[model samples]
Target: MDHRSETGHVMFLSPERVFYAGLLGRPRNRSTGSLLIYVGLGGRLMLTCGGRTQADLAIALIPPFVEHTIASDARSSLCFTVEPESVTPAALDLLARRAADQGPALAERICAAYVRLREGGCGPGFTTEELDTIVLGAPLARRRLDLRIAEAVARLNDFSGPAATAADCAAAARLSQSRFLHLFKQQTGTSFRAFRAHKRARHLLHFVNEDLNFAHLAQDIGYPDSTHFCHSIRRFYGLKPGAIFSGSRDLRIYRGAAQAEATAVAALA
Candidate 1:
């Protein structure tokens, strides 16, 4: 697994897997496929998952089935995502609440304890008691609607392109549109449309930087036309696609010309 920033990285852990830890750079729409316990050591990062915003100076204990996209500041950060299935749901819920409350000190302690367990520093039977202590000390109990909204936002990472409307998302959550909107704002502190747009923009930026196949990238990401695509690029980044790729002069369009060139190169190679 390449954890390097420019090349994007992904790791998969089976249900039995436990205590996976590492240092990560600014991650874009990278799926963990399990619960993630991220500790931000240096600069702040903006993490959009499950319709929630996990931003600056915060430690995140993400739940399973959640999708996360992270953008780091100038400094790099250390993050760990552990599969929490081995622990009781009560413990997991407690940790999630602590992270939501931005309890970095408590998060750090938990991480340290986890690392010790992974490294054989602690005996086999110690985990249950330790987790209980941590959970008891941490703040717990948040609204269920808030957690559901966060789960919805996290689901976006599974999407390869553009996102469904708030109504669409609300329906998926089995809630009315109005109720979903209210809960989404209350939980994540941002609107559903805004969250979707941010996720799309991040995906677009990744495609741009990676020089991915433009047309497919556009369609994969949910834009009907180059005009709409370009408009979105401008709206989010404040720069036209042309301006973004102006000097370098690769294919100006994301679809036809660029795809043709890439196809030809692949055939020849």
Candidate 2:
């Protein structure tokens, strides 16, 4: 028998296998014997699974026989599933009695462990056990508006040349244009347009060495015309696009400046 096929079957039998496998974005096809818990930290997520209202940092303790889908707004996450019969009776009873407030410290630890795991570092052996303990202790809180907005801002840090509009960002966030603008301002303490322009300027500084066509770069990043794009760059960074990319300044200077600006904006958000 193929080990891969057997592995699939075994995934349903053990809670550890079930929990870790869920984190990889694929769940076993059958939900009849699984319970899933989603803990959102700093971003927005959309769940396709039948559930209550959509909100930031939403948590759903899905019982057996329910299937769900989850989407997040450029933020990291930690999710797990438990086999119905694998969890101790004591653990199930605790989960039934707890409220959402009891999961922050657990969330924090999970987030930290996830980061370490992503970086190829050795995570503490007790991390998963601690996570299980937290889930049993209390309900996990929802994500905050400020963190979601900050995540939006962070996404822009990778943009270069020209900036996208609030409407574009709203579509990305899956929110109404008006609501996105309001929420963006509330969380980032800046207008969406301003933040986008800053992001574009930072990208241009980083990519100026590449023999990219200004017009194409502008259009690629959502600007309508080269003239308008250059004008925006000049107004914000006090340097025309051509002049900055002309090789006058040391490449290191441009890189350092851009990184500093991006860092400052992130900190502000």
Candidate 3:
């Protein structure tokens, strides 16, 4: 039975990862602050960047916040989003090697791991460690995010009911606006504005499979209107909210992380 048909609920995959697996339409261009690894199950996955077809891949790794398009005949895929600040040098090296290799060993490992999860129908949420092991060829020590930047990112993720400004993050991070702006980019590998926007846009995941009013959900996620919401989300996820909703009618979402555990414990209480 479809879980969404009953409650349209959301579940955690891990603290740093959340994904929807099921039928999905071809994605439009999008980018995000986390590394995106995808496996096109049941069909070929094509990745395009800079107006050229970069890879016709079954499994692939895309670095954080890089613009790209996904085209596939596959009805379903597994998308893993790892917080970039937590990415290891080894992992980065592996991603780079895999990105340049047509038949990288890393891709095969990632594909195999994703197949297991996909065959399990999106349950058994994966740990960030498992994701690391699959893509990096070994478990690498998690790189720590800059404390100030991490605080700011957490503040942004804490609440979507209100809009947060760059100044707010700068203040929360306890840095001069100018310094915060510079350091944020240097630390997070994305601009402050884009990072906040992507974080807000990422929250849009919780409601993707819901039948709520787009305009209302837009505001709930701090977008000024439906247009901005659609555009911003597409800018990151490469698909519009409506298109995603339609395609993921029976979608299975799994979230992961320490955050997910806390949410579970709270619910039980």
- Candidate with top lDDT is 3
Segments in model 2 whose C-alpha atoms lie over 4 Å from true places: 1-145, 160-164, 172-174, 248-250, 253-269
How good is model 3 by TM-score? 0.80
Better of 2 and 3 by TM-score: 3
Which digits, one per residue and each the tens of the lDDT, describe model 2 over residues 106-170? Answer: 45554554444334332222232443443343222222345546556545654432355677678
By lDDT rank, best first, the candidates go 3, 1, 2
Candidate 3 worst ten-residue window by lDDT: 5-14
Q: lDDT per prediction?
A: 0.49, 0.48, 0.66
Q: Model 3 clash tally?
A: 9
Give the top-scoring candidate (TM-score).
Answer: 3
Cα lDDT of model 1 by residue, 1-269, tens digit? 32232221211121122232333433545453345666554456577877777667456555654556766563434444433323446656766676677566755675565444334443332332333343234322322435567567655533332467787778888999999988886765556666565555444532432555566666777677777777776655345665544422221111222233433554576
Per-residue lDDT value at 244 in model 3? 73
For each candidate, give its TM-score against the true structure. Answer: 0.38, 0.37, 0.80
How are the candidates ranked when ordered by TM-score, highest leading?
3, 1, 2
Off by over 4 Å in 3: 3-15, 102-104, 118-126, 134-137, 159-161, 261-269
